[model samples]
Every structure is written in C-alpha cells, then in structure tokens.
Target: MPLHPKIAEILAILPAPPDGPLDPVAMRAGEESQVPPLEQRLPLHAVEDTVAGEVPVRIYTPVEAEAYGLLIYLHGGAFFLGSLDTHDHIARNLAKETGLRVVSVGYRRAPEAAFPAGLEDCYAVVHWAADNGEWLGWNGETLAVVGDSSGGTFVAALTAMAQDAGFDRITHQVLFYPSLDLDFDVDRYASLRENAKGYGLETGILKAFNAFYLDSGADPADPLVSPIKRADLTGLPPALIVTAEYDPMRDEGELYGKRLAEAGVDATVSRYEGAGHGFVQHFSWLPEYHRVYEETAAFLDRRAE
Candidate 1:
C-alpha cells in the first residue's frame, strides 16, 4: 500500500538533513519543529513521588471518579531527549481514552546516564505505582505498562525484569513501534535505508543514539538490555503491540509479539499499512492515528474487564 497522503505531505515538508552527527540537542529541536505544540491542559493531579530512594516521577490522574486502571508510561526519546512536556499529550490522551491514570516518568537520559540508569528509573516508577496504587485511588493489580519507540525498548526490558524480579502487579503491556533488539541486522532496516521516506527514523541517527545509550559494561544481549534476547517470556501479562507498516522497527516488534505468543502469553499485534513510525503521537492530525488510539483503548478496556 502507498503511504498515507497526510504522512506523505508532512515528509515532503521536512527540513534538510543535518550535516553533522545527530546529537540529543539536535534530535530534540527537530522533534519540536516537526510535531505540533503539545496541549497545555494541566494533569488532573500532578504529584511528585520518589521511587528507588530518590528517583522522582510525575503522576497524572484522570478527573473521572469511575476507577480506571493505572498505566505507567515511559516517554520515547532514544534514551536521551524526551521529557514530561514532550510526551504530555500522549499521557493525557491515554488517561482520557481509557479512563486510566497515566503516570509519566521523568527517567534519566543519556549520554549523562547510560543504559541501566534510564531503565532503572522506569522500573522504579512501575514499582512505586504498584506499591502506592490504593493511596492514589488506583487498582494496583490492574496496572499496565506502555511506551513508544525507545520508550518501548524500556517497556520491553522492564516487563522482562518485572517478571524475573517477581513484580507481578502488571496486568498488561502496550508497545507502539518499539525497538525490540539492538541488533540492526533485520531486513526492515535495509528496506528503510533504501527508501528515503519509507521510515521516519534515519538509520545512521538511530545507530548513533544506540551507541551513546549503551554502556561499556553492558552486554548487548542481556535480557534487561534487550528483551528479545530473553530465554523465557512465560507468565508475562497479556500485551497489545502496535507497529507501522513501513517502520524500520516493524519486524522486530512483530517478532517479539510472536515470541510472546509462543511462550503462552496472550498478545495482539497490529501493523497499520501506509503508516510509519511515531504515528501514535499524531492522533490529532491523522485519522489513521485516531483509529489506532481507538483500537488501543478498546483493547485496554476489554482486558481490564
């Protein structure tokens, strides 16, 4: 199928590629320019809570009293640039759609804090949400984990760690166009590299970000570093994995979903044709994006029930 018309138009308007290597600063500025301004509405309740000694998190609760499940979301920025502000719209939309309280973590980014630091921050927030669910008027046992792109990488890692560490509070996991493996040998990457507009993610830029985020001491194959490397995926919560038809990460995400199914985990994987990476964040601009949001909400609602 051809690319969506709106996406094609947006791609045409993108600025010229940078002459130098892509750094965190450049990535942040590029993202801001491409995306629309985030909505300024305040979270129903924004509270700073400490996790794992001193890791701080900002939790956003929905206004409705209808007791929805808790969704602990980690924002995507290739482990470097995203913040509560950058991903605030997503948190708000998720909260409103599922009637779930969305707790968005301000996880430490790299090159300052590499590999495990960002993952640890996300883990801490999940643990904190589970421990203090009732205090925040949420059902702890009904907690879900969600993320996109690099954040999806963390989500995959955290889910695996949670299972290994006996953090059984999570009931579901959602990944949108997730980068599941550090190994970039997949055919999808090759396909993307050949077509300029096939994938929004630049291969070289992605490689650069991965290099900066991984630590010298970290093994690329560690299940905590790459969830797809895990030997056992059993007993993990049911998952809803969304991918883009033309995304470089598409194959890996689909492969992970397959592994989950093989391990007896209930998983639903969907790839929207004519879409590329980061479509979930553009729900307000694209009808296809809105369709994804509705599908995701329906999936969550059914699972929660």
Candidate 2:
C-alpha cells in the first residue's frame, strides 16, 4: 500500500532530519517535542509516577472499565531517546483501550548507561510489577509486556529472559515495528532499502543507534541484543507483532513473529497498510492508530475469556 494520504500530508509539512551524522541529544529533543501535551494525550482514571525497584515508572489505570490485565510499556528511541513523559499518552490510552493497567518505564539510556543497564532496568520493572501484584491490583497471571521500536527490542529480550528464568508470569507480548535484530545489515533485509529513508526511521539511524547502545566489547549477535537470534522461541508467551507497511523494521518484526509461530508459540503478525513507524504515538493525528489500538485491545480482551 502507498503512504496513508493523511500521513503523507503531515509528512509534507514536516522538516527532515539534518543532513549529517546523528546528534543523540538533538535527536531525542526533536522527537520528544512532537509528543502532544500530557493533558491532551490520555484521559485515564488515575495516573501515577512511581518507582518500581529503583526504576521509575508511570502507571495508568483505565477510566471506564475494571482492569483486565497489566502491561509494562517501554518507550522507543533507538534505545537512546524517549522517556515516560514522551510516551505518557500512548500508555494511558492503551490502558483505557484494553482495560489493562499500563506501567510506562523510564529505563536508563545509552552513551551513559549502555546495553545491559537499560535492559536490566526494564527487566527489573517487570519483576517488581509482578511481585507487587496487590499494590498494582492485577494478578501475575494477566501480566504482559509491550514496546515500540528499540523499546520493543527490550520487550523481546525481557520476554526471552523471563522464560529462561522459569518465570511464566508474562502472558502476552506486543511489539510495534520492533527492532528485534540488532546486527543490522542492509543487504540482509530487502525492506532496509525499500523503506529506509522517508517512513520515519531515517537511513543509517539503526547503525547510529547500535553504536551508541552497544559497548565496544559487546557482541551484536547476543540473544539479549537480538532476540531473533535466540536459539529457542518455544515456551514463550503469545505475541502480537505489528509492522508498518513502509517501515525499515517491518521485515525483521515479521520475521521474529514467523520464528515464534514456527517454534509452536502462538504469534500473530499484523501489517499496518500505508502506515509508518511510530504511528501509535500520534493517535490524535493518525486515524490508523485507533485501528492498531482496537486490535491490541481485542487480542488482550480475548485472553481474559
């Protein structure tokens, strides 16, 4: 499908990234500025910014329905950008749409807290959220994890780690255009070239993210870095892997979903036709965001039955 006409119109007026090497600070600031005001983001019954085991988390409860489950949402910024504030609206709206208590984590970022540090922070929040079931008002059985872009990468890594640790607490995983494979090679995935430039993820940005997020001695192929490289996808929770039609990460997200299904784990891959990456965060401006939210809510709602 072609670009959604509405998105295309918005893109027309948007400024392109500076034509040079990446500046993490400016990049983060630019992205964060696009988020709507907190009040305009979501209307939740309650929203609390609290700490979970040393990790900061913003919790959201639905306004209209009794909570059905709990979700730990990791914001995406190529692992270097984004924070709880940048994703507040999405988390709150997701909680409202799915009747799931959403905890938006403020994990450490790269250049300052590279690799395992950020991942560990997010992983810790998951455990803390589960261990404090009474406080969160959700049982461990209905817990799930969600993320977009690099945050989705953390979701994939944390889910795999949780399974390996014999903690079957997480029931589902939701990935939106997730960067599952960190060892990115343009030649390896055709989508890299086809959708590399204009669909939100600028070309060469992945490499820039990798350089900042990974330590010099770290292995890119480490399963923690690239969940798609994991040997066994079995015994993992069911997943709803969403990909944007023209996003560079589309193929890899779908590939991860394929691997999960082949490993006998129930996984569903849904492509957003004519949509770009990060569309979920721009719900007020993008109509297709509602479609993804509806699908997400239905998937979680079915698990309750």
Candidate 3:
C-alpha cells in the first residue's frame, strides 16, 4: 500500500536528519522541545509522580474507572531519548482511552545507564506495582505492559525475564511498532530495506541508536538484548503487536507476533494501513492515534480478536 497522503505531507514537511553520526544528547533535546504544553495535553482524572521500587514513574488514573486493570507503559525514543514527561500526553490518554490505571516508567536511557540498567528499572516498577496494587487502586492480578520503539524491546525482554525469575504477573503485552531485534545490520527482514529511509525514522539514525544502546561486550544478537533472538516464546503473555505499513520496524514486530502464536501464545498482529513508525503519537494529522487506543482497550479487555 502507498503511504497515507497525510503521512507523505508529514514526511515532506519534516526536516531531514543530519548526514553524519547522530549524537544522542543533541537528538534528545530536539525531540523534547516538541512536547506539547501541559494545558494543551489531554485532561485526565488525576496524574501523579511517584517512585516505584526506587524507579521514578508517573501514574495516571482514569475517571470512574475502577474495574479495568492497571497498565505499565514504556515510551519510545529509540533508547537514549524519551521520558515520562516526553510521553505524558500519551500515558494520560492511554489511561483515559483504556479506562485503566497507567504507570509510565521513567527508565534510565542508554549511553549513560546502558541496556540492563533500563530494563531492570522497568521490571522493578512492575514489581512495585504488583506489591502496591491496593495503594494505586489497581483492580489487582491483571497487569498489562505496553511499549513503543526501544521501550518495546524492554517489554519483550522483561516478559522472558519475568518468566525465568518466577514473576508470572504480566497478563498481556502490547508493542507499538517495536524494535524487537537489535541486530539492525542483518538483512533478515524486508522492511529494513523497503521502508528504511524517508518514512520518518531513517535507517542511519536507527543504526546510530543501535550503536549507542549497548555499551557492554554483549553481542546484539543476545536474547536478552534482542528478544527476537529467543528461540522459545512459549509461556509468554498474550500479545497485541501493532505495526505500521511503511515503518522500518514493521517486519520484526509482525514476525514476533507470528512467532508468539506459533509458540501457542495468544498473539494478534495489526498493521495499520498507510502508516509508519510512531503513528499513534500524532493526533493532528492521523486518526490512528485513537484507533490505537480503541484497539488496545478491546484487546486488553479480551473483547476483540
């Protein structure tokens, strides 16, 4: 399918990335400046900032929603960027749309804290939420995890870790155009080439994120670093993986869903036509933002196929 007409306009109007190596720090500032002011953000029931297992997290509660379960959100920004504040509107709207209490993790970013550091923080917050469900007014027991881009990488690895660590608390997993595989150099997926550049997230920039994400000696192919490297996907939580038609990350996300279903996990993959990476974040031009919310609510509620 061709790019959405609006998407083409978005791409045309957007500035092209620098031709050289992208600096994580510079990119962070550029992206952070784009966040809408608080008054312009969605009106939620109540939003609070608190610590969950020593990790800072922002909690958003929906108005009169006491039945829906709690959700943990990990925002996208490759790995070096993104924060609770950067994605405040998203978390707020997610809670409102899904009618669930949302805990947005402010995990440590890369080129500073590195890989496991961020992942550990996300897991710690989940543990804290499970232990303090009553205090957060959680429905209890039903805990779902959602992430986009690099954060989605954490969600995938965290599920496997939770299983191995005997933390079988996550009931559902949702990934938004996730970068499941860190091995970006491989030609394992066609979208890497088909939608590599000029569709929003350029190929060079993505490779740069991959380069900065890992500071350790661990290979990019490690299962913990790249969840797609994990051979056995059995026993993982049910998943709703959303991928965009023109996004470079599309193939791995869809493939992950296929692998999950093959491993007997209940997994559904939805490709939003004429869309690309991070389409749900933009509300001014695309309706996919609301579609994401509706789809997620239905999936989390087990009311959709």
The candidate that achieves the highest TM-score relative to the unseen native structure = 3
Each model's lDDT comes to: 0.76, 0.83, 0.83
* Superposition error at 109 for model 3 (Å): 0.4
Please write out the lDDT profile of model 1 over residues 1-305, one tens digit for every residue.
88788888887787777687666777777666654453545445443444434665656666756465888888887778787767777877777777777888888888888568889889988888777766767854468889988889888888888988887888889999888877665364454455334456655556676776764334567877667888889888889999887777777789899999999998999988888878887544477577766776777776533
Q: Number of backbone collisions per candidate, in order?
A: 0, 0, 0
For residues 86-135, what per-residue lDDT tens digits would candidate 3 score against the true structure?
88877887898788899999998877885678888988888888888888
Predicted model with the maximum lDDT: 3
Mark the regions of model 1 whose C-alpha exceeds 4 Å error after superposition. 29-53, 186-198, 215-218
Error of 2 at 190 (Å): 1.3
Q: Which of 2 and 3 is ahead in lDDT? A: 3
In candidate 2, clashing pairs total: 0
Q: After superposition, how far is residue 48 of candidate 2 from its true place, in Å?
A: 0.6
| Models sorted by TM-score, best on top | 3, 2, 1
Against the true structure, what is each candidate's TM-score?
A: 0.89, 0.93, 0.94
